[model samples]
Target: MYDPKIFKTYDIRGIYPDQLDEDVAYKVGRAVVEFLKADTLILGRDMRLSGEKLSGALAQGIVDGGADVIDIGMVSTPLVYFAIADYGHEGGIMVSASHNPPKYNGFKICRERAIPISGETGLLEIKHLVEKGKFEKKPSGQLIRTDVLDDYVNKILSLIDKKRWKDAKRLKIVADFGNGMGAKTLSNIFNTLGVKMLAIYSEPDGSFPNHEPNPLKEENLKTLKKLVLKEKADFGVALDGDADRVGFVDEKGETVTGDIITALLSKEILKDNPGAKIIYDLRSSWATAEEIQKAGGIPIEYKVGHALIKEKMRKEGAVFAGELSMHFYFRDFYGVENSDLAILKIAELVLAEKKPLSELGRPIKRYFHAEEINFEIEDKEGKIKEIEEKYGALQNAKVSHLDGLKVEFSDWWFSLRASNTEPLLRLTLEAKTKELMEEKKKEMISLIQG
Candidate 1:
């Protein structure tokens, strides 16, 4: 049975065998080929236990739908995007439920040049096709087993010249791969550079025996933080299930939010591409824009979601973009999330400054953030309108409905958005002072909870 719930705003994800078995994968594959009208497509998967069988079924359907499949097996989601954009495949699919538990699995679809096919783009039609359970049969296509790992790694290394070393050896890092796809490229890059790194759970295991592959949760990063302090490493990084997202831990065991990374990278990226536009999600701290402006780069506040950010970057010709969820997009990588490249960029910044990661990130922490708060409300938009009717009337408030409701003042700001993937309302507030942030956050909560 095709569980319509699996078709999400971003991708198709659900519990394996139950909600998203081989049958669903097969049907989705057929729908993708039929919809894209593609002659050839690239395919890749993560280290999920169910990936092997599911990929086999998906390839069968793609072949049945008259599109040849270039199966780049057991690679990161970034690698799949690279194969599609850099190699010029018509479209592609990555079979991996990013950051989800072991029992869950899914697929991320993309078009030519790695453009994502979100619910707004074409996922809903694909869902309907799967539900209809019908496809016009054509000549069965061939499946070619290919490995693009070497090329992907070379692309990552090209950004950071290995010949120069360039003080890179002076930096030491503690990385937690969480037994996901990150271990593949990180291992190759560090080995080629001969950088000292304390790698934890580097092995590619579908079970994710060490911890859940989500770095956003503070608990998942506890071991990484501990190792960084114990090893006296300059910094630490944790890669999520598919290695497309990442989280950073500084030298002092402080968690560096994604926005702060954007601010830090702004300084480094702007040095080369002066006046380049950099996009950050609206949830980011004000210091993100401040740092970008200071570095002579244009800072653009955009709504969240990887697909939307990628499109916004392409349209604005942004050199870099970062989301609060730790997804970093780079123009060099065709405006897609590349956690490996993000890591290398951070390393380069630290090496160039000859300072600790904390020192490099300190200036970016200039404002007070209430952190993201989530409320489970049945009527999310109704509550948002209620809050808007109240705050929008303020004489000094500037309201924007870009991704959600954002009311801003000279001293404070807040963004309330309904999550695209889950049934929840997310609130992000910041202010010039910590006290002000707390006060505003509390006030916002009352409105949302009511």
Candidate 2:
């Protein structure tokens, strides 16, 4: 039996063999098939050493549950989503840890366009079934191997016009794959685009020799930044373990946050699709909304998380959506979130402007944003309640509880929310000036700690 503790707020993740094993994986597969009543399912796995074995066992379980399994071996998370929708399968699962350490592994599931399973959605039910060991066994169905990589690459390339890429002069770019699945798929796309690419750690090694695949961490991005400047490349791109999240570095060796990229892309999209609806997560910079409005697109802010963003996109009929954590979703792409597509879009926009990305970002409004701060506390709910009671009555400030306690003032706002994954409270603050942001952040921290 697996430890119940490993079933997380987002996906099922844990150390291999000890916390998660083939047995647990099979149980999860059985539960997923039963839960969705899936007659046919698409499955993909990352390059982790354990992935192949786990996927095989999971497929076995699915087949045993009388569900046919279509295995697309060794692919990224987004590619799995694509295979599911493109092939019109009933549901799909990607066996990947997604930016976690090499020792960790997990699954990302989807049914149609909806991420049907989350911590509160169907994960708990799956967990309960796994623990109870009451899975119903049935006759074996079928398993088939289908190589969809070429089709996936073709589909992604079709999203961008080839003439646009060919018209632009070839630009030198560096891509640090962090030894994840990105290395496996990026080559085909970049070669087709005719870009001069310098690939680093382009092998699929789950141990992540050069650095962890998480580009959000400055330490993880240090090498990519230095390399970009050293090679004088136009830009550098970084991807997470499953290649679902992307990070960028400009020619000047400066790391750009996902929010800035979102603004840049939203402006480009609005130029053609005027008044299109764009969605950004609440944690994004205030400039994101202002830029969307400036570009003549309606800006809609929603709670954090891919599932939340996708749902809001459907509800608002939003054409595009971006998250501060680097997950970008496109409605035209069957609403499947793809960081590779976002990176390519950014490249295309920069080429179209004939300007450096840094220069293009200057006219946009700038706001001082504090990195998300996490506070470890015994009572997360109590601390949030205290923060609400203290800040709820402040004059000239509006209080909201959409995702957490968000207090909005004329020039500044702060969001204090309990993290779903850990026993901690996360705080994000932004303002017109650095001084004001710091001042408010200090006050909010004091109140929250007390």
Candidate 3:
């Protein structure tokens, strides 16, 4: 039941039943409560079919460990974060694989204020406890079922200034929930904001009868792109399995990269809080930083991953932060991911500018971005070192080892790093010209993949 490999950098995840099962989940729940030394723990699960058994087992373990369980059944990943923070629970567990295939299931554990439990933080201790397979015998606690969706929606609205989006009703958009837990809150948020939403596959389905919930895959986004153009809507938004990540399609049926959204949101945020600091992942396009600076905001580049981003945002006092993976974090959201809040801000922009989504996204897209590419390699660290040494030797090259290897030349830049959740090396290259971007991409891929 305790698979050591299932313990990941940010969370615990693996294939269902085989790598992770009810027994493992039950042990994890007990371990988490004991690790946090808490009396109550908030729990939520995504739309995965195994979520029922896993959540039930987890809640029983928590209760057996003398920790009451506040089970907010069947919701998106974000709501668990909201519940932990809003209700002042000591810790929370979200039973989700977060964009993984249906065969996969995992847990995203968080502590007070919804702070993530990364490996460096306290995950190892929990793993140690789980492997021990022992819990102190105590009086069993109660299982409490409640819904925090209403409060979660209210919190999302409080973060957005409704006065600025008075014309949201005029905006028409398509949202592909991909049959995940996204509809749990996103559809409601859109409706409450008076946006004309054509939501497809909004029903929560673990089987994902349509396309998989992962919007990062271009193939999965085909339906969304076609719908946006067919309906002639302002834009389209696609949410991942758990709605913690989101992707956008312009009205012209063009896919909008997450870094571009980061750039746009940075500018929008700076309008209200000039000279404030903004955080962006190092893999983002240079346009993100330039736009932040142009809008009178200080741009700070941080390491990738949701856990690292939240820590950096709080440390830097950043008003907003976004990743190339479409995960946007906000100070208003208490340093947590809120796909609904990001959409709300985007809606405000569309309503206020009255411009096509493509036009609105055009300015910050000054540089050509090679969408992140992955390579299956055995010696991920060794490859990164070899590439780093070669690039770091270049004259006038600005290199950073912040997350992995990032070397910036005058016209082009590239980043290479191992994925935290997968055993693969990820590369992101950008340049001033399309040809240059392609050229650099080829040059970098050889060293990393070869």
User: Which 10 residues in a row give candidate 2 its minimum summed lDDT?
Assistant: 161-170
Tens digit of per-residue lDDT, candidate 3, span 1-450: 556999999999998888889999989989998999989999999989999999999999999999999999999888999999988989899999988878999999999999999999999999999899988897999999999999999999888887887888788989999998887687788778788899999998888899888878899999889999999999999999999999999999889999999988888888889999999999888988988998999999999999999999888889999999999998888889889888888878887777887998898888899988999999999998898889889899998889888999999988888999889999989999999998888888777667
lDDT, model 2, position 308:
72
**Ranking, TM-score, top scorer first:** 3, 1, 2
**C-alpha displacement of 209 in model 1, angstroms?**
2.3
Model 3, position 398: C-alpha lDDT score: 96
How do the residues 1-450 of candidate 1 rate in per-residue lDDT, one tens digit apiece? 456799899999999888989999999999999999999999999999999999999999999999999999999999999999989899999999988889999999999999999989999999999999889979999999999988988898888645446666777899999999998889888888877888999998989898999988999999999999999999999999899999999999999999999888778889889999999999999899999999999999999899899889999999999988999999998889899989988988887777899988887788898879999999988999999999899999999999989999999999999999999999999999989988888888887886
Candidate with top lDDT is: 1
Candidate 2 — which residues are off by over 4 angstroms? Answer: none
Backbone clash count, each prediction separately: 0, 0, 0
* CA lDDT of each prediction against the hidden true structure: 0.91, 0.85, 0.90
**lDDT value for candidate 3?**
0.90
**Model 3 off-target regions past 4 Å?**
none
Score candidate 1 by TM-score against the native.
0.98
> TM-scores of all models?
0.98, 0.96, 0.98
In terms of TM-score, which candidate is stronger, 1 or 2? 1
